[model samples]
Target: MSQDLPTTSYALLGLLSFGDDLSGYELKQRADRTLRFYWVSPAMSQVYTELARLTKLGLVRAREDTTAPTRSTRRFQITAAGRRDLQRWLSSATVEFPALKHPIALRLLMGHLAGPETSVTLLEDYLGLLAERRAELQAVRDSLIVDPHSPVDRFRYPRMVADWGLDYYESERAMVVELIRRVAATDT
Candidate 1:
């Protein structure tokens, strides 16, 4: 591993920004629920491996949770050195978002290479998936009675996440249907 650390290293550092000593599981949940909208997750092995590497580099420190009977249970904390490293990483380079290589985008780009029927089938399948996702999001959102001042809502990052997902999926479903109509008209 390079001394500079990978993208996930900064992700771990960013979680530490919340000012809590967290177990790996807690860290994973936070990343999944909150950071996932704008960040990628490393594999479970990669997370643990990076945590170990961060410990070795004095950027992170792990201590046994004495409150737990099992010594294997540990929580990690960011050191002053870790904070400095994170600051340096942030200042040194611009973060590059990963290029989207979505199946829909690929199908759209090359749909002309396929038969009209094939294109319609692909678009319909994608539309079905989007509709399913939108339904799930709607149900989840409907279940939540929004209380802006609720302490629970304040920390429920995933609710905000679900809201964004609902809007995006709805938009995508509409766009795909319109594109399909255009494709059909053009084929005639």
Candidate 2:
């Protein structure tokens, strides 16, 4: 775990989680499937750039294709060195989540500058967004429960947690909609 391993290098480890060697395209697709919820996929250029750096650092090894006659399609595998580096990083690294700075909180803080109508409209808009998001999460929860192969669905406790989240969002959305209706009805 060289502290010098750039942030993008962790993503290469993520690609290896499937326990298969992958061309950069295959790696990118796998990363998209698993990491899209948390991390952005590196652009094709960024993937190549990271591969070059990781190879230079001895964290990943590449093999040239003799028959294909294209260098861009060369495949990579995690080196023994790379696996050791990854395990060391996992054991030694401290996890630090980025700061939480909610845009909605910022808007609420500055909202007095907006007149009552604007404030009400903003709240309504926010409610709409929340409802839409709740629906999306609901779909995710449903799919997880019904899709037998979903990783989360295999564990009973995590499935319960997902159900709880689905209920929580639906409850919150209803409460917010009701509160908005009450506020809009009240006269000064």
Candidate 3:
């Protein structure tokens, strides 16, 4: 229960606070499938490392699953203290804006170096990635809407954030499409 844990620590705590009793692998999957779209996605190693740190700090309870075939299998859940810390952090004002490390944005900025054709190719490739992510987000949102009693129903505020991400992605895609059209026209 440190006062100033990294945001990633709180992120993991927030995930654990969901009461799913997820293993590290499951946590990693949940993050990748849901949070990675908007928030910082930790590597597998970072997940495990943070789990250990949280365990040491008594913010999370990790139990070794002896019955499981895999050795050293651990499932973790947030402690009461962890929940309090997460709640406190959630209530706190924003410390900073989200960092943008968009490779596509950087490439687009330097598109002149590679010429319009290459920029067009990059945009197309980006479209493929964006489509995949958008579809995944939509499918999950649709499933949540269809099954109102699902575990995800608990995430009221998080859903709003997800809505924002969907909108952001769509807006980004539209802008890119326009950029590509402009570039293609100039190329011709």
Candidate 4:
């Protein structure tokens, strides 16, 4: 069953496992808030399409929410089958190395043409942007609830992942600073 669905489908199932009956719009919002840090957040249209496919596969159950003040809205929750499939995929899937697509690195490789000044400027600008992103991710890390007394903290893993992202950003910032210095020292 897992082989039939794309990875995004599994991502949605994982989102729903948090125990909220969410509409497609809400799902997109959640993805934007969380997935953007580490993974590509699926477009709104993709969210709807995946939801429809999951519904057809009996992995998700959609029901009309009549309590809405305006027109009825459809909210979705993961079915038992979805949970089983997610668990199976998590346990059995072979993890692949993360693909790096660093635009800055690509540009830096051809820095001879752009000259040292341009390369220094590029690396400096990246530092500012990295700081901004790091702060935003830090805010997200701060917002997660971690209860030490509880044997099971649903947010424990999320907090760990957020910390990992924060560390990654810090490492990138240090590397960019070094690159800036190196470029500025270049003869050309």
Question: For each candidate, C-alpha RMSD in Å?
Answer: 4.6, 5.4, 2.3, 1.8
lDDT against the true structure, each candidate: 0.76, 0.67, 0.85, 0.89
lDDT for each residue of candidate 3 in 56-167, tens digit (9 for 90 to 100) = 9889999887886777778999999888878888898477877888898798799779888998999999999999889988876665443466755676666777788889
Cα lDDT tens digits for candidate 1, 1-188: 23777788988887776578988777776665556545666666767887888888888889888896766677988888889888888898676866666887787788768866778788889999888767765666666665777655533564676788877888888888988897788778
Model 3 residue runs over 4 Å out of place are: 67-72, 146-153
Indicate whether candidate 1 or candidate 3 has the larger TM-score.
Answer: 3
lDDT of 4 by residue, 1-188 (tens): 64657788999899999889999999999998888888788999999999999999889999999997989999999999999998998897779787678888898999978889888888888888899989999989998978788788889899999999999999989888887877887854
Q: What order do candidates take by TM-score, descending?
A: 4, 3, 1, 2
> Model 1's lDDT to the true fold?
0.76
Off by over 4 Å in 2: 1-3, 65-72, 114-188
TM-score (C-alpha) between model 2 and the true structure:
0.58
Q: What are the clash counts of all predictions, listed in order? A: 0, 0, 0, 0
Name the candidate, 2 or 3, with the larger lDDT value. Answer: 3
lDDT of 2 at 62: 85
Give per-residue CA lDDT, model 2, range 27-68, as digits (tens).
Answer: 887665444334566787888788888888787888775666
Q: What is the lDDT of candidate 2?
A: 0.67
Range of the 10 consecutive residues with the lowest summed lDDT in candidate 4: 1-10
